[model samples]
Target: MLAGQRQSAILEMIAGSGSVRVATLVEEFGVSDMTVRRDLETLARRGLIAKVHGGATLVDGGSTEEPGFVTKSGRQAAEKEAIARHAATMVAPGSAIALSAGTTTWTLARHLVGVPGLTVVTNSIPVSDVFHQFGRPDQTVVVVGGVRTPSNALVGPVAVAALQTLNVDMLVLGVHGMSPRVGFTTPNLLEAETDLALVRAARRLVVVADHTKWGLIGISTIARLEDAGTLIVDSGLSREAREELSEHIDNLVVVEPSASGN
Candidate 1:
């Protein structure tokens, strides 16, 4: 294939699969690995895709406009880790916590592995797996039963019913987007409803999202910003954006990347 043709094909593959590894692209296009890397680098420079350690993902895939696990996971890695670390500090030992399903929430789950005597209730397969992978005997995980969404979140009547029965001390929510007018929103309608249930089931709501999520609006609104007890975001957030968000949210906890160590 010609250089242009190869690049076009690679773009199509990323659009279809949300992400593409360099090795896979090289094999498919019968090109050298360097050629594939160059294509990805060009795309990343154009803001068409995000280049990660082993792959490239469509830029739109990270937004709620596209719901792909691999695509979302590869974007905002450092920001998510910072948010998760800050979120983990809010969870006390032996506390009953409700965790929503999202890339940021998954990061929090990984950090929660060492917390003892904690009861985690979640509707995310990966969230449950994180606990199961490294949870202590005193730490119990409750998987809320439901139909899984495209973003790997459990939703529907089953999930809502399960959440209704349990009362959690805090809910760590992950949203697709957040805007002053639209508040917290998600692309999936059912998942939005399920998230509302999660909000109702917990005494306090702590939303964990990176600065990228600000100003973006999704299809469905889960809750108003003021409803949340805390909003955890990265240091990259601008002063103007922070001021705007503070007006809507009650207790905004901006977690800077450097503060993660503390």
Candidate 2:
């Protein structure tokens, strides 16, 4: 196919999903990876798409746009680790906690492995796997059931139902985005519902997000600004942002990336 035709097709794919992976395009067009990258470069130059870490997204990838887990996981690795490290200190050993699915919360799960005799409930397959791979015998992990999304979060009725019966000491939640108006939000409607159920199941809510998540909005709102008991973010957050978030959230913890010892 012609270069223009291939670029057009790529745009169509991105339009359908709000984002597209280069590997998927390479396979679809039977082209070299380098060739696909050049095409993406051209399209990005045209201001039709924004180049992301692993792929491209609509330049205006709005409130409903959500990238896949792998695509988002590597975007802010150090900052997420720092945020996760601070969040781990908030959970006591032998307490029950729910980890909502997202890259940041998954990072937090790994940090909690050494905390003994804890009960973990999670809708994230990766989060559960981290414990299964390294958790002590005293640690119990309960995997919630539901349809999984590109973010690797189990959502829908099954996941919501599972959260209803459980009461956790704290919920270390992850969100797609948050805004002064929209609060904490997720792109998938079902995930929003599942996260809400999680909010209700926990005695306290702690949100872990890097600076990049602020000022953004998603399709569904999981909670309001004051809902979180504590909010942990990386040092990349601006002073203005910290002051603003501090006013709404009770305890806003910001940690430098180097302190995480990653």
Candidate 3:
């Protein structure tokens, strides 16, 4: 396997079990110990994992540590862009789409610019701005009012209340992390609550997440894997991870980064 593919698989292994021993990885990949160590080193430098005496572990408190939108926007650019492009294709012309706040969904908003006569409801300031700048006059953008979370998502009684009254054809959700066990999760408790509200407002739920989000667990879960009808991920997602997720989520769509132009 390629180096990037191996690292992605290693990360998923750690995510599934919390920690992985070097000996186990060596046996699994049939690679030299030095190769595994180098892989661990690379993942550590990226702040994706922590090295231990014998192996590595997923970074501690990833579930609770919330970074700002700008910080996250830089973390998984290619993967997010690819996932967003595929998600945008799912939107029909004149459809009402609900976008929950996160960097990936914000990327999805950028791809929605050309769709005609669409109505977008969102709590993200940046997402609303995308529609404001590029959306056509016939398109409608509704920004929900509420308190902003660290990730720049608006959430509170107000956002939830607004969603309770509106129904959309689809909801595109971005999350901090996800797994078969936790379904879809976010570090912020209130954001999880508001996201669940957004999930209820749509008939079809499509989750957009990158491979890096695989093993990380957030404090609160928005829904079980079964709740979402489809999940959009990038080509970098590992085969093992994809197979595991396929058992829970119905539709798993993988897209290439280069496929996105607009």
Candidate 4:
């Protein structure tokens, strides 16, 4: 196969399966290891796929499936780290915060370790595990009980009921997509419902998303643009998209990867 044909096939494979190993690609395309690596390099440069230790995974934006933790962790490592660091600075010590589930929120959970007197309410198993490992005695971690989704997020009626009973200082949310019309959305209906409950329970709704999520659309709309108290994104976003988002949301905080200490 020609290089262009091989690359197109590789993208099709990732689109269908979410990831592809280097060896697998080589065997499938009947190409040398170097050729497969070069193809992956080109795709990664275009932000179509993320290069992993031994393979490549499709980037998170516009994914059809709710990606597994391993897949997500492999993609957008630098962006997530930058977002986490900036998000951590926004948390006041001793605040009761509600965090939604996603790779970005998981990164934020890592930075929350040293934050003293924090009460974190979440439905993500990974977020709960982060606190279980390093949370201080003064800090409290509450995991909402519910059915687990493919993304390892707890959702359904139980999670929504739990969130409705509590009030939080801030809600840290991640979106599958963001647009002026849709605001924030998720592919899963149950997850969207749980997110809505969290939005209602918090005094301030803060959305943390990377640039890739800007133009995509999900199946369920969680909140309108006017509902967010603040929207935080990376500097990779286009100026036009940023201006459009800022016009609808009250406070828009765009943090650069360097300034965020990623």
Candidate 5:
């Protein structure tokens, strides 16, 4: 298998358990000890794993720590729903759109199911599943090809290749974190690469993120702050943050969770 695919498999194993020994990886992949160590070293550099004396362990509570979809789906329920609700209104009927992998984007997919004659491209398994269960007959859903992350996002070189062949009217993205310096970021390096491809495949970009995403930094950046054509955030964001974001994003929208009705 290719290096990227091998690395993705290694991350999956680490995610399933907690750590992987160099000897175990060598045996599992039929590769040399040096190759396995190189994989671990690459992952460690990205902050995705912690290197021990003879093995690698998962990273938690830092820039590279990525929570599973189930663990994150329940967080900031109201805020995410509010952002999704408002973001749904930005879509026009029959428009081709790309939805990045995230809980908020899955929620937005639910909202888009009824829109007539629309086409949706996504790398998120859960987001595509939403449409599979509820999409109208006139709608089309394209599932990008790649390795699955803990968040159920399909990302890697395969996903990037798929995205390069398609163009969409808009890209509705959800990020792990955002800041002035690093802009939009993700904990997974492969995910970041795939997201950047999605950004390039679209004409307009709309970012949907809750207030808590502010100030946190991830291992890799997907885009700069000014890259987003529109950014929809919840009112829980501080007044100072709103001002700071508005300076970069021309269309910065803040919705009150209570007032934003589904």
Candidate 6:
């Protein structure tokens, strides 16, 4: 195929899947790895995609455009599920937990349905609904009222004020992106502020993110990596990235999605 055609095909693939690895493209297109990079670079130059560490993701519209829940929930299905389940194990009964809005944390909310005598606070509409529908009679669900973001998170002064009044056992935060330099981040500034409030109200920060979240920087920083008491990720993380993140995080739990228990 012509160079233009190959690059166009690559763009379509990224548009369809949200991301594509160079190695996978190389194998799929029967081209060299360098050739795949060139194709990715071409699309990136056109602002059609964003080049990441080992792949390319759809350009996120400069931190102003937050993806909806449907888009994010589709990105890493198995990984998010596994990460959510693993994070749920850390919760003890009768604990007060704050859940931030995001697909991964929403997944974690589902797993918490069985935990008895829990107090759940969240800015996520879907997350609060999870507890409302399935929570045990002893559980208390605190819905933080505020303006909702594209990611379906209720953020702003209202949400921040609600969080300020109570301290929780743990805050399970799901972020838009994560990096060594900036820590956990979000594209929305108000959402970031609300997340900070959640962090402040918790004894420990438990972050749940997929491997793809690495290297994607957002507009606002939520917390430094070391601030998180526990970071849960899926097995898809590369060894180099894992070792790097481990340096900053106290307990880095990498869950294997393929495992029977996961």
| TM-scores, each model vs. reference | 0.76, 0.78, 0.81, 0.77, 0.76, 0.90
Question: If both were scored by TM-score, which would come out higher, candidate 2 or candidate 4?
Answer: 2
Per-residue CA lDDT of model 6 for 1-262, tens digit only, reads 9999988888888887677777778888899989988888888888889887777888867655688888788877778889998898999999999999999999999999999999999999989889889888999999899998988899999999988998999999999889999999999999999999999999999999887788888899999999999999876676788899989988999987753434
Estimate candidate 1's alpha-carbon lDDT, on a 0 to 1 scale.
0.84
Cα TM-score of candidate 2? 0.78
Q: In candidate 3, what residue range of length 10 has the lowest lDDT sum?
A: 253-262
Per-residue lDDT of 1-262 in model 3, one digit per residue for the tens?
A: 9999999999999876556768889999999999999999999999998775567766855567898888777765777888887898899999999999999999999889889999999989999999899888999999998999888899989989988999999999998878787889999888888899999999999999877677678999999988989999876566777888899988999877663333
Find the 10 residues in a row with the least total lDDT in model 1.
Answer: 57-66
When sorted by TM-score, best at the front, the candidate numbers are 6, 3, 2, 4, 5, 1
Query: Given candidate 4, what's the lDDT at residue 80?
Result: 71
Error of 5 at 74 (Å): 0.4
Query: Lowest-lDDT window of 10 residues in candidate 2?
Result: 51-60
- Per-model lDDT: 0.84, 0.86, 0.86, 0.84, 0.89, 0.88
Q: Which 10-residue window in model 5 sums to the lowest lDDT?
A: 51-60
Local accuracy of candidate 1 as per-residue lDDT tens digits, 1-262: 7777877888888777555667778778788889899989888788887765456755644334646676688767777888898899999999999999999999999999999899999999889999998888899999988998777888999999999999999999999888888899988888888999999999999999887676557789999988988999876565777888888888888876653333
Candidate rank order under lDDT = 5, 6, 2, 3, 4, 1
- Tell how far residue 129 is off in model 4, in angstroms: 0.4
Give one digit per residue, the lDDT tens place, for model 5 in 1-262: 8888899999998776555667779889999999998998899899998765456656647788899999778767777888898999989999999999999999889889999999999999999999999999999999999999999999999999999999999999999989898999999999999999999999999999987677768999999999999999987676778898999999999998774244
Better of 2 and 6 by lDDT: 6
Candidate 4 TM-score versus the reference: 0.77
Model 4, residue 171: distance off in Å is 0.4
Error of 1 at 230 (Å): 0.3
